[model samples]
Target chain A: MGLLSKKDAKLITDPLADNNPVTIQVLGICSALAITAELEASIVMAIAVLFVLALGNVVISLMRNIIPSKIRIIVQLIVVATLVIIVDLVLKAFAYELSKTLSVFVGLIITNCIIMGRFEAFALANTPGKAFLDGIGNAAGYGLILVIVGFFRELLGSGTLLGMQVLGDPIEKTGVYAFGYENNGFMLLAPMALITLGIIIWVQRSRNEALIEDH
Target chain B: MEKRTDKNSYTIIFATVMVIIVGSMLAFLATYLKPQIDENKRLEKQQNILYALGINDNDEKSVVFISTKDVAEKFDKYIVKQIIIQGDKVTEDDNAYLLDLKKEHAQAKDKGHQRRLPLFIGEKDGEKFYIIPMLGKGLWDAVWGYVALDKNLVVEGIFFDHKGETPGLGANINQRFFMDDFKGEHILDGTTFKGITVAKGNADPKNERKEDFKVDAIAGATITGDGLTAMIKKDLRMYMPYLQTLNK
Candidate 1:
C-alpha cells in the first residue's frame, strides 16, 4: 500500500481503460497501425515503447524542478530521445532481426505523441513514482490495442499467428481454401487497422456510456 | 534558485549541459554496442549469402532453418574464394567483404569513378557458384541483394532486401516467393549481357524465348519492381568485365 497507494494505483490502471492512449486519447496511432501486422512485431514494439515511456517519464519527472519552464519542451525531448537511442542500440545488439523488421519505427518512438503528451501533461507535474506508473499504464494500454489488432490481422490476413500456421497451409500452398477459410487480404492494410480501432472504440463506448462523447 | 530557473542564461546553460550529457551517453552506448551489432550484421550478411546460394539446413537436410550461430561457420566452409574485380582485372589488393557496394556505387555515380566489385565464389556438392552483390534505389530508400549464378551465368538463387520499402507491397521483395523467381534466370545470353527483367505479370506467358531471363513482378509494387530490375541490370552490367574474363 505504501509503494502504491489507492491514488497511485489509479495512475497505473486508469490508462489501461478509461484514459487508454490508443483508444481514448487516440495517441500513437501511427505505430499502432504500422507494426501491428504481425504479433511478434507488435510485442517487440510494445516492449520498446514501454521501456522508452517508463524511463523517459521518470527521468523527466526527476529533472522537472531543475528544468527551466521556457526550455521545458526541449528538455523533455532530449530525455525521450536519449531513452529511444538506448532502446534502439540494445535492440540492434540483441534482437537484430526484430530490430530490422521494426526498422525506423523504433527510432520514431521519440516523436510518438503519447510519450511527448505524457511528458507535458503528467510527468512535468507528477512525482517520479506516479509518472513512472502513468507511463507504464499508458504504454500497456497502447500495447493491448496493438496485440489485439495484431492477433486479428495475422490470423485473418495470413492464416497464421506469430508466424505459426494455425490455419493449416496457406491457400497458395494448398491450392484450395483449407476448411473453406480464406485469408482476408483487407485485414493486412492500414485502413483495416483503423476500422479495427473504430470497432474497439465502439465496443468500449457501448460497454461504458461515460466514454461516449455527448453531442 | 527561482531567479536562476527563470533566467534565459540559466536555460542556455541547462540546455548545453543536457545536450552534452545526452550526446556522451549516446556515444558511449554506440561504442559499447558496436562490437555486438557488428557481429550480428556479419552473421546476417553470411546468412544472406548462404540463402542466396540456396544452401540452407533444408538443402543440407539438418534443420528446417539455419541458426545464426551456424551462419558464419557455414559461410567460411562454403564460400571458397573472395574475388575483387575492377574493369576486366582481378584485383588482389582489396578484400571483397570489405568493399562497401553502396559507397562504391555512390563514388562511381557522383565522380565517374570505377571501383572494384566483390564476387563471392561458393562451392557446394561439387558445383561452383558465383555470388554478386547488388545495390540500387528503391521507391523510398536503398534496396540491395545477392544473386548467385551458376557456371553459365544463370541465376542459381537470389536474396533481396530493402531498407524502407512500403510494407505488404515493395517490402515483399524480402519474401521467398519473390526471390525464388530469379532462380535459373540467365544474366548472360551466350556472351550477350541481358540481365534478368522483372516483367509486369507472370513472365512465363509473355516471355517468347523461354530462356529464363524474365520473372513476374509483384502487383502494386511496380516502383519497387522497377527499382529491382534496374538494380540487377546495372549492378550486373558492372560485373560484365569480370564475368567476361571468366568466359575466357
Candidate 2:
C-alpha cells in the first residue's frame, strides 16, 4: 500500500487467477500447446516471456505519445523482435547450451500475441510504470497456467517431472510399472495440451461464477 | 480532432527512422558478438566429436560434455589426425573440422564437384577411432551428429544434435537413451554398407542384437528418427571407400 495504491496493486494481482492471460483472456495459447510437453521447457519459456513482456511494455508506453497510430503494430513488433534477438545473441555468446535449448522458442516469442495484446490494449494508453506492472501480472498469469499444464503433461505423458523419473521405468519394470500402470502417451501430443487447457478453464470458471457467461 | 501521430506524413517518417535505428543496432551487436558466438560453436564441435570418441563427463543418464576451459587441450591430446576425403583425393588438414558440411553437401549436386568428407582420427588407450561428422534434415530443422567407429567399422559411440526439433519428442534425439542405443550397432553387413535403422518396431527392444542394424526409435519422433537413419546411410556410404581401405 505504501508503494502502490489499491488500484495500482490490482493491476499486478488481478491476472494471477481471475484475469489470467491464458485461461481468461485466452492469449498466447500457441506456445502453451507447443512447449508444455516438458516442465523444464515451460519454465524456460515463461521466464523468457517475463523478461520480454515487462521490458517491451515499458518501452512502448514511453513512446506512446509519439508512435504513429497507423504503424503502431509494426512499432510494437520491432520492439519485440529487437529485444528477442538481443536476448538470443547474448545467450548464444555466454550460455551456449541453454541458448540451443531456447532456439526454437526465439521465433515463438516474437509472434506471441500476449506481447502484442498488452502493447495495443494497455500500453498504448497507460503510463510506463502502470504498463510495466500490467506486463508482469499478465506474464505471471500466463506462466502459472503453463506450469500447471506442463506439470500434468510431463508427469502423465512421460512418467517424469523435469526429466526425472517419478513413476517406474516402463522398460525396467520398477516403481509404478510393477503395478501395471502405464504412462499415457497421448498426453504428450499437442491436442492433449488443448484438452488440458480446457479442463483448467472449466475448473477456473466453475469456482468463480463471475467468469461464466450466459449465451 | 486529429492528432499529430495520426498524420500519414508523420507515420511514414516514424517508420523510416525506427527501421534504421533498430537495423543498425542489431547489425552492430551481431557483428560485435560474432567472435564469441563462433568460439562457443567451435568448442561445442570439439566437445561433440570428443563425446562420440568416448571422452566425456557423462554419468549413467545425462549427456555432459567436457568443460569449455579444458576442451581445447583435451581435443588436441586425443585427436591425432584430421583428414578430408573427396572422391579419390585424401588430404590431411588440421582445420578440417571447420569445414561446413551443409555447403559441401550442396556442392555435391554440381556437375563434377565431389563432396568433401571430414573425418577425425583419435587414439585413446592404444585404440584408434574413425570419427565422421554427419548432417541431415530433422522434423523441424537440421539434425547433425558424430559417429565413431573402430577399424572393423563397428560403432564405438555416437552423438546427435539438432537446430530446432520439438522439445520433448523429436528433440530427445540428443538424450542419452537414444544416443546410447546407437552404440555397438554395425554400419556394415558382411562386405556391404548396410547402415543402421531407427526402427519403431524393433524386435529386440533391449538392443542386445548389435548385428541387427537397428535401434529403438523414440515413441513420437518418427520423422526425426527416419531422417537420422537416412542421414547415417547417406553420409556414411560416401566415406565407405576410404573406410574400407582401413583394414587393408
Candidate 3:
C-alpha cells in the first residue's frame, strides 16, 4: 500500500479545521493566550512555531530508523533544543526590540506540547515528507486562530492596527467618539486573550457536527 | 569481536565535558561584553547629566567640562557646588548626591534611602543653570528624573524615566509636552526654598508657590504623579544649604 493517499491527505488536512490545534484539540493554549494581545508579536510567534514544528517533524521522521528505541525521545529533545537555540540567537541579533518584547516566550517554544505531540504522534509514524507537510498544515491551523485573535485584540484594544492609528476621530480636542479609554481595555492583561480564544474555539467547534455531540 | 566497555564512565565523561564547555563559553561571552556594556552605561549617564543641565555640546567637550579638574579650574566662573540639608541641618554631605542612587539602591536591596541631593551648576553664554535629580517610587517600579533650572532656580527643562510603568499612562512623563510644562517654574524665593509642587488640570503653571511648585500630574496615574511631586520636593529640600550658598 502506498504510504500517503488522497484519503490520508484528507485526514491530515481535516485536523486543521475539524480538529484545530488551539480551538478543538485544545493544545498549545498558553502562547495562544499570551502573544495574541499584539498582532506583530503574535505573527512573529506564529512564524517561529511554524519553523520549529515543520523542521522538528522532518528531522525526527528522518532519524526514526537510526535512533535507538530507548533513546529516541532524548534524541528528539536534543534536535529541538538545537533548533531553538539557533532561533533565539537569530532573534536577538536581528529583532532586538521585538525579541525583548517577546522575552521568555520564544524560549518556551521548546516545551510547547504541540511541537512535542506532533513529533511523537504524527511525525514518528509517517514518512519524512508527509510529516513535514503535516507539521506545516497543523502550524498553519494554529497560526490562523492566533492571527484572528491577535487582530481583533490589537485593533479594538489599542484603537490601532499594527501601532498605526486607523481611527481618525480625536477625543482630546473635540471630545467626539470619546470612549475615554486610552489603551483598548488594558491590552497588557492575559485574561482577555483567554476569553477571546475561548470564544473562537466555541464558534469554530459549534459548526462541526462530529464535535457537536460532545462524545 | 566483543569488548567490555564501561558505559557508565563514558556517559559521565561526556556529561562532564559538555558542562565544562558550555560553562566556559558563557563565561567568555560575559567577559567580552562586560567592558562594552559598562561603556554604554557610562555614555548614557554622561548624556543624561548633560541633558539634565540643558547643555548640548559635543561629547568630548561634555567630558572635559564635567571633569573635576575643569570644574575646579573654572569654579567661580561657571560651576558652583552645593551642600544638602534637611530641617535646617545637614543630613549628609554634598558628595552623597554625586553617588549614583540606582547602583546604591540595587546593592541595598531597597533597604536604605540613598537620596540624591547634588545640584549641578553650569554656565552657557554667561547664564548659570541648576540641574537637580529626583527619584521616586512609581506604580510598578522606581522612577527617576532630572530638572534643569536657570541661575534663578527657575525650571527650564525636565526628563523623566520609569522602569516598568504602563507605556501610555505613566510613561508619558518622558514626553516633551509634559516636560515643557515645567519651563519658567521657580523653585526658590531669594534664599528660602519653596520646593516643586503638583498642580490640578487647567490650573496656572505660574501660580505663586506658597507651598508647592504647581507641576501638573498625569490624570490616570495620580499616584505616580503625586509620587513625582513628593520626590521633587524632598530632593530639592536636601539641597537647601547648597542653594543658600549659591544665593550668597
Give candidate 1 regions above 4 Å deviation: A1-4, A94-98, A172-182, B1-4, B58-73, B110-112, B166-172, B188-194, B197-223
Model 1 TM-score (2 dp): 0.87
Q: Pick the candidate with the highest lDDT.
A: 2
For all predicted structures, in order, the TM-scores are 0.87, 0.98, 0.57
DockQ for all models, in order? 0.43, 0.78, 0.09
DockQ (C-alpha) of model 1? 0.43
For all candidates in order, the CA lDDT equals: 0.81, 0.94, 0.64
Kindly list the per-residue Cα lDDT of model 1 for residues B1-248, writing each as its tens digit: 45669998998898898888889889998999999999898777788888889877653212123589787778889999998876656765324765788788767766646587888999988999989899898888999999998877888988898888765557778876677667777777788888988888553533345476788776557889999999999989987776677767
Q: How far does residue A15 in candidate 2 sit from its true spot (Å)? A: 1.4
- TM-score of chain A, every prediction, order shown: 0.91, 0.97, 0.83
Model 3 scores what on Cα lDDT? 0.64
User: What is residue A94's positional error in candidate 3, in angstroms?
Assistant: 8.4
Model 3 chain A poorest 10 in a row by lDDT: A168-177
lDDT of 2 at B16: 92
Model 3, residue B125: C-alpha shift (Å): 7.6
Residue pairs with backbone atoms closer than 3 Å in model 1 (clashes): none
Q: For model 2, how does the per-residue alpha-carbon lDDT over B1-248 read when each residue is reduced to its tens digit?
A: 99998999999999999999999999999999999999999999999999999999999899999999999999999999999998889999999999999999889889898778899999989999999999999999999999999989999999999999998899999999899998999988889999999999876767899998999998778999999999999999989999999888
The order by descending TM-score is: 2, 1, 3
